[model samples]
Target: MTIALRDAREQLRDRFLFWATLALVVASTASLVTGAIALHSDAATYAAARDQLLALGKDAAAIAAPEFYPLKLMRGMIEQVEIMGAVIALVAGYRAAAAERGRQTLALILTRPLPHWAYRLAKIIGGMGLAAVSLGIVIIATAILLPVVSGIGLGTDDALRLALTWAAGVFYLTVLFTLGFGLSLWARSPASGLIAAFALWILVVLVAPQIGDTMDPDNQVAGGVFAQLSVPKAEQDRIKAGFAGYETFRNGIEVASVTKHFERFTFAILGIKDTYTGAPVDKVLAEKRGDLLFLFLFSLGLGGLVLLRPINPDRLTKES
Candidate 1:
């Protein structure tokens, strides 16, 4: 255990690790500040819009509803936080193993009595530990700063939701780091490993979701389904015509109501809904955690295979 800790400490002491941690801290702080400001600005605009609607003879109940503007601000902040988390993870993962490979010290380090897997595991733990600390600090800072700037209180429920979101972010970062380490082992060169890892990250994190969305048939709907529902076409047309302008009014009402409802509920500290369209977010989080664990095992498995391969030091010296 001591040996492992020493190895991990040495890894973290490296210049690259120091710089990476610094970068994560700076970037996370900036992201939180920017997100808070933007959310506050949006909330102010929404309040003004709500007043205008009320002035136009909309009932106070309709204009002052909880779902009107607050939810939008919260949702936008969540998205920005996720993006910032991804950036921190990606940068940290690319540097984890690639830097050592670039220095050509990987082979020397592997030759030690300490197991190769131990070194890899220590790097993974240390890198992720650092990232986790940064994430926690950002969350804490955001919680305090947002209320001050936006006048939106952060309740226990908000903290819980943010915690779950951060957990997901950490899982994603761990997977990327392990995969990057594996690529480093394969390439035996830091630059090549970094490039390949980032390319994979982009494919998995960005492109895959888009492709998945496009491939989902549910995203597309045809007019034929409604037409074939056995209702009289004339009756359907009459209903549609009667409600021609209803969509706009209904949307406005929904927006106002939801906003107001959430605002009151936020004060009550009601937890966020953990499921989206029948899919439990907790289940998704578990799956992601499992995936990250598998990736770490795979990286270790490959690293062990690399270690088992016989290396002829004499042949290398002769060639040199």
Candidate 2:
């Protein structure tokens, strides 16, 4: 344990970690500040729009909902944070392992009295610890800074959501690191390992999501562009029955209300909508947690393989 702690401390003291941590802090602070400013500006615009709509005798309740504006602004800000966080994770993860290989220090480290697993474990824990601390700082800064700038305070639920999102960030970092570490072991040089890891990250993050969406059964193309575009009579009747008592919105205002007859019916029971665009907040949170867990397990599996591989760090010559 003492040795592991020493290793972690040494890792943290490296210049790479120092600069990476600084970069993360600056990036996160800037993003939060910009988001706060944008939200405040948006709030002003919304107020002006609301006044104009009111002068025209239009219902402004939907557009002027205080909760709606904050939610939209906050969600957008969170998404930006998520994107930056992922990039930080990927860079940190790849460098964590690749640096040792680049320096040809892996052989020396493996030759130490410390067991191979300890070194690998230390790398994983130390790398993740640094990322978590960096992310936490950003989260704490945002919590304090946002309310001051945007007049929007984060609640306990929001904090929990942010934490969960950060955990997911950690999982992604771990996956990238493990993949990079494995490639470092397999490749002759650090450059090749980094390239391979980054390419894989791009494929997983970008292509995988698109593949998932494409394979979704609900996402389908129907009839030609201009063939009266009507549902089958039976389907039309079913749809009408489902929407019999639902409110409909056009633009930002609710213009029509269906009868109250379906009030007792569950959304599922009535099949009113296949899925709501904005899901129940709790479900979304749970899904994020699940994604984090999946990534963590996958990374762990990869790391395990790296641990079990024979320690032949001297296989690559100086020329190679």
The C-alpha RMSD of each candidate to the native structure, in angstroms, is 11.5, 11.3
How far residue 71's Cα lies from its native spot in candidate 1, in Å, is: 7.3
The models' CA-based lDDT, in order, is 0.51, 0.55
Question: Between which residue pairs do clashes occur in model 1?
Answer: 65-260, 66-259, 66-260, 66-261, 67-258, 67-259, 67-260, 68-259
lDDT of 1 at 274: 28
Candidate 1 per-residue C-alpha lDDT over 185-206 given as tens digits, one digit per residue, 9 for 90 to 100: 5554545666886786566555
Maximum-lDDT candidate: 2
TM-score of each: 0.55, 0.63
RMSD in angstroms, candidate 1? 11.5
